[model samples]
Target chain A: MTFSDITIHAMAERVITYTGYMARWQPDARERLERAAFDLFVEQGFASTTVPQIAARAGLSTRTFFRHFADKRDALFADEHAVPDQAGRIVAEAPDGITPLQIVASGFDAVAAAQFSREKSYYIARHQIIQSDDGLRERQLHTQAALVEALRSGFVQRGSDPVDALLAAHLTATVFSVSIGRWLSAESTEPLATLLRDTFDRMLRTAAS
Target chain B: MTFSDITIHAMAERVITYTGYMARWQPDARERLERAAFDLFVEQGFASTTVPQIAARAGLSTRTFFRHFADKRDALFADEHAVPDQAGRIVAEAPDGITPLQIVASGFDAVAAAQFSREKSYYIARHQIIQSDDGLRERQLHTQAALVEALRSGFVQRGSDPVDALLAAHLTATVFSVSIGRWLSAESTEPLATLLRDTFDRMLRTAAS
Candidate 1:
């Protein structure tokens, strides 16, 4: 039978749509606003993009836009809130016998598998936008610090020491550097999960060596 | 036989000098600009203090003050540049056969021994400043990120995986949270080095647990 005739087709489609909602984002007013904001940010840059213009492009009033996002900078950094929850879910569900570091690595794998593929170009653009503004970069750093704190709390709940919890959280966050390296390389055919895992393993061996 | 007398005399001299320096700092010089800025920041408040007032307090021209620090905020963050070099030295000189986590922990220990004790009040004030300002807190996060990078490089040079190096660096940095906690508590007369060693031992055991 053809692939479409198989029972797995519907399940695969459901997964694709679900994951792609994370990857490409779902259809919503926020998506529309984001699209408009992204275009404005890319064209005139984050510093110059006015809220009224973004609202106009999104077919919303300035007041409505403000209801959704605090400002233009907020539009430029909309993905942060979802990341920690996704990571937490994955870590909480990892197979038994894995180390905290390994569990975090797996959490990263799940988050990346859900979000990275279609998000790449958008993320690169987002990175550029953040880099162009010192304040935005500072905010990004704050977001990361919060992420580490959240992950540390998770580890602490799992019976890790306060010190080890913080350590595991920090180590897990370091995977971002590796992810950036892989994303920027031309030969990166491997999935983000595999990249994160391999990077963690190699890093451990390197430390042991 | 007279070691106690010599130690007491040294302690008395340190108290005298520290008090003198605190008094001698004026409300207007480039040489002691950071100290003056810190004083103003603590007295009036970081956000309320202007560059001109900070320069005037230090006994330096505003331009000269600018030459010393990028801005008013820079004065509150004067320790970061020198911290990494001292930390690197400690890492390089760590006792042989220690685990990488222990090596990193020792580096912080050395830093605490050399710098932390004398500046405890300034640090507490700065910590308060950062806690009050979101921007300063973000700068602090950036400072931590840079330290992580430096420690990672040190590990990699000693032949670590780029990933694990980052993890080790991050974990080591986390000990700062615990150390800071102990420092603020006003109990625990344990040396920072001992506290860090105990922390590492505790983490190792927990990870195994």
Candidate 2:
């Protein structure tokens, strides 16, 4: 909360922004590319948009665009490395006595708390685009599979059994699905984290019953 | 248990054979393809083999080969769908009092038991081939993701929470990793089901502790 603490936190975030393997581009470049890609995808459909057109729209060279992303398909999903570390750190910092699943859910809750309210429209649009394309759906699955691996490894490092590690991964992923659905319902105004917590609470009740 | 039951099971196995999903001329076509693919993969390498060479060596036309598989890669990996239905059936038949995770582990046990006693060399070859190919590895990950979806859906239908369903799918998959590793290392002929059960037991103990 001190000015020094704030400065240190900003420096840490900036370091992660550069050093994170999941980060494919500088923030400004990513934002521009995302805006260009989303507009083209929505206007002409994802399948029809060529990489050249996306590059042109973003005002970046085709080579530069490739430098930022391995390929056009890579842009369809969020970076896996960025999400998992944040999620894992949140889960790891939770109360130790909670069940592994609960710990994992708390991580998802942290993600939801930080991103959902600010980017509701972007989330809705992105979800629609992904749903419309089989390739994108598969890519989404791949992203999710990576997230699970990251989370499971985190749990295993914490001395959990492989099964509990996997359970934590999957349970956290479910919280993701549930929160996304509830977020898109246009009926809930609560923070995304609260929706996730409620989802987990409901599951625990069901299991207890 | 009856003569009729044995007859029907044999007939179904015969149907699988006639479908040319396995090789046609070789009585051990499945075994031959697995060995040949693994050998070529280890020696000449996976990228070098053409469909024609695999067909000629197997003593079949490329058309007959296509009757069995969509591509050469398809022959290398085992069919996942071949087991999930049986697994879901086995899980569904378990005692109602068992937890969802227990039911899933039981299903994993049934499938693993069926696969564990097979030729160790074949597995080693397959593992080598897959490890050397990134595209193949991605395909395998996609297959596992599909399996997770199937398992989670089954749990969801049984009135479990979405989170619990996902957790069950992942936990079962983790036990699968443990069971497979344990099965491969043993000199004694322990049942795969027993291995899976032991893994699950250890996981539960770890969670409780």
A140, model 2: CA deviation in Å?
Answer: 3.9
Off by over 4 Å in 1: A1-27, A91-99, A117-119, A185-187, A206-209, B1-31, B59-64, B89-109, B154-167, B176-178, B185-189, B202-209
Weakest lDDT window of 10 consecutive positions for candidate 1 chain A: A4-13
lDDT of 2 by residue, B1-209 (tens): 66755654454445444545444345665555555555666777888776555654554455655666777788776564655566566655777676777677556645765654477666666766876776677666666667667777877777776666765665566566656666666363666677777777665543343
Alpha-carbon interface RMSD for all candidates, in angstroms: 4.0, 5.2
Docking class of 1: incorrect
Tens-place lDDT per residue, model 1, A1-209, is 65533433344344444444443443475777788899888888988777766766665555556777998888867787667776676667767667787677556655776666665667778778888887898878767777777788877777776667776676566666566666656667766777877776655553343
Residues B138-207, model 1: lDDT tens digits: 7877787777777878877777665577667765666666666656556667766677677666545433
Encode model 2's per-residue lDDT on A100-146: one tens digit a residue: 67566546545765655457777778888887876677677667767
Error of 1 at B53 (Å): 2.7
Model 1 TM-score relative to the real fold: 0.74
Please give each candidate's TM-score: 0.74, 0.70
